[model samples]
Target: MSILVDKNTRLLVQGITGNEGDFHTRQMVAYGTKVVAGVTPGKGGEWVLNGKIPVFDSIRLAVNARGANVSVIFVPARFAADAMFESADAGIPLIVCITEGIPVQDMMRVRNYLDQKGVRLVGPNCPGLLTPGEAKVGIIPGDIAIPGNVGVVSRSGTLTYEILYALKQENMGVSTCVGIGGDPVNGTNFVDCLEMFEEDPNTEQVVLIGEIGGSEEEKAAEFIADRMTKPIAGFIAGQTAPPGKRMGHAGAIIEGGSGLAADKIGALEMAGVQVAQHPEEIPGMLK
Candidate 1:
């Protein structure tokens, strides 16, 4: 089984009236996700996308009335932290913040509150997670993934897509594909998704796509070395990243020797994870 979300999840869109919200929400619904309700303050008492689901004024009302357990936020960055707390307060167990540009300090505060409340968050700047052929909770391309036995977890959204494309070229299918996001302070990390994949029966192998940034990869390596019972193949992006320079992803910046791609690859190698030298080689490594 997939972790976090499956076909049974009931979704609530926070900024349902916004353009981004409308776009992805329709795609999610079209992909067969159970989008039960929406929340948009003044837009409450209105209907979204063919009047399929009811829109409420607040997250609390939507959660309470529709029994929504999962929430996907499309609110602007200025109010993203509040949106997160709103979902947490409403007691939604899982929340995915698709909004970008949230202040770092605000995100830290939201993370602290979520920690205290025992809430699980996916991203504040992420592509989200998808359980192939089951349910999708973020902005990942649904068509690229097919239900199978391999699990993919990545830091780069585009790289995640590349990995999936490579895997599909090799005729491999994925059980779940997660874009843990590129934010420095995202909700989920490599190790978090790894743990979930380790426990999923459908996952026969795992592909961890990492990028230059933080000690997250090192932490994940240590965890896998000591705890994992499955075969893991990994690839750390930005190998060609110029020293003392940043990359495209905001969180891909290198500083203080912490976010180097070499360091992450070294750590994963020490952990017994097969490290791929190129993106194109990932599928072969998994095989």
Candidate 2:
């Protein structure tokens, strides 16, 4: 079974009227995700996708009327935090925030609020999650995946796609693919996804795609060494990145000699995980 989403997921777009929201909403629907409704303040009583989805002014209204158990945010970064707060207040069990560049200060508060409210958040700058042949949420392309037993978690959306495509090329597939995002202070982390995959009976193998950043990979390594029983293959990006120079992701930087790709790779190897030298090598290790 998938960890965060599946066939039962009823999703609502928080900023459905905007361009990014509009485009991805169509893509999700085409992938067969049960997009129940959308939320756009002051655009209530409107319809989109050929009048298939109804838009409400607030998340509470959408949740009340359409039973939107999951909410995905597409609003601007400045408004992204508020969107998450609204989703939690509306009792949305899971919230996915796709907006990037949200201030770290705002996310600190939002993270605490979500923890207090017992809400699960995916990303503030992410590609989203996908359960192959079941549900699609966020920006992850669905065509590259197939229904199977491998579970994937990643800090990079582009690398996530590359791995999935590579797995598909080998006729392997995934039970779930979660892009946890590459932000310094976003919701969800490697350990959280690993715990979920460890408990999922449908997931026979797990693939972890990490990068040089915070100590998240180290934490996940510890968890895998101690508690995980599933066969795990992993890859860490940014090996050649210079210290103190930020990479493509805002969170991918080395400072004070910590958060190095080499360190992360060593930790995973110590945990008995078959760490790949490159993204394309991941699928072979899993097999």
Candidate 3:
């Protein structure tokens, strides 16, 4: 009952010949993800990982040959947008983009195209999603997550890992942990993930980890108040960050006094969410 991905995911890796792609592909395989195929353009017909997975010249070929329903992109920033377009055109329903530093203008176009095509994009600068004890997509470590009822959605990659580790230590497991990314124009938002989590039968509670920048948290708070029935615990990062400063993420910046940490926390609290002061406090709050 994971939200997006699970053990049945037949995955294909775009840019699988590159260093990052090759390395993480093996890690995903080791974690028991059904990595059926890969795409590396000129390296078609070759085999990687000791000849276990077939490499294709394009996503269309990979999908047609192996029934790859999920595509994970590891290409560079410059080529990421085109890779996404290719995947969508090739009929890959879900695309996860892990490459960072993509131009905002490029992502704007990508988002529009994906919406028009009815495709789902996880990230252009995200850590990807994890379905514990089932499938591992993107770069989220598979070791820290175990199958359970709580659903996790976060805007920060590193903070997601920290919260996951703490939950593991407390013997808490998650159904799915989605890193929607901290990009200004990235695909999928907190409200989207929250909706999925709300509809998922296996999810009994939700933990939302947000940072400064963007009105995403505020928007999610509105939705939580209006529609959500499950108990929610939250943590907002960048409480001490000064105004007009860009934090670690491209979208993490204070602008025109709009994206203050206090404002987001207030919104969530008013919606009846238990807000945690620290990442480690999240597990207890959820409990």
Candidate 4:
């Protein structure tokens, strides 16, 4: 009952020949994701990862030849928007863009295109999504996840990993973990994953790992209060972060008091979501 990916997810890597792309391709294969093919323009007709994956000239070719329904973009940020458009044009239903620093305007167009085609895009600066014991996409560590009823959605990569580890350590495994990316403009948002988690029968609880920026968390809290019935826990980072400073992530900038950690915490608390002071406290709240 995984939401986005499972054993049957035939995957395509858009820039599979490059350094980051190649490394993660191998990692994904080792984690048992059905990485059927890769796309690297001029490298077509070639084989990557010791000839295990065939390289295609285009996403269309990869989808045509490999039956790839999902695609991950490891291409540089400058070309990430194009890669996303290409995957959508080629009819890839699910796309995960790991490249960071993509211009906001480019993503605006890409987002519209994806919406028009009904594509599910995970990120542009993200750790990717994982369905424990089922499929691994993006860069999430496969070992930290275990198939269970709790669904996790996060805005930070490292924080997501930490939460997953704590959950597994406490024997509270997850159904799906989605890193929706922390960029100001990208594909997917907290509410989108939350809704999916709400509808997933396998999921009994939900965990939201948000940061001190963007009303995305606040918005998600509103949705949870109104529509979601699943028990949810939350942990918002950057509690003491400097105001107006961009904290590592492009979207983690605290402007005025709108996107502060305290505000996020208060909103989630008001929505009846247990707010955890630390990720370790999250597993306990799920109980």
Q: What is each predicted model's overall lDDT from 0 to 1?
A: 0.89, 0.93, 0.93, 0.91
How large an RMSD does model 4 have? 1.0
lDDT of 1 by residue, 65-150 (tens): 89998999999999889889999999999998888778888988999999899999998788887888889888888888788889
Per-candidate TM-scores read 0.97, 0.99, 0.99, 0.98
User: Residue-wise lDDT of candidate 2 within 1-287, one digit each (tens)?
Assistant: 78999999999998999999999999999999999999999999999999999999999989889998888999999899889999999999999888888888999999999999999999878999999999999999999999999999998988899999999999999999999888889899999999999999999999999999899999999999999999999999999999998897888999899999999999999999999988888888876
Q: What tens-digit string does per-residue lDDT give for candidate 4 at 125-195? A: 99998998888999998999789999999988988998999989998889999999989887889999999
List candidate 3 segments past 4 Å from native. Answer: none
Q: What would the TM-score be for candidate 1 when compared with the true structure?
A: 0.97
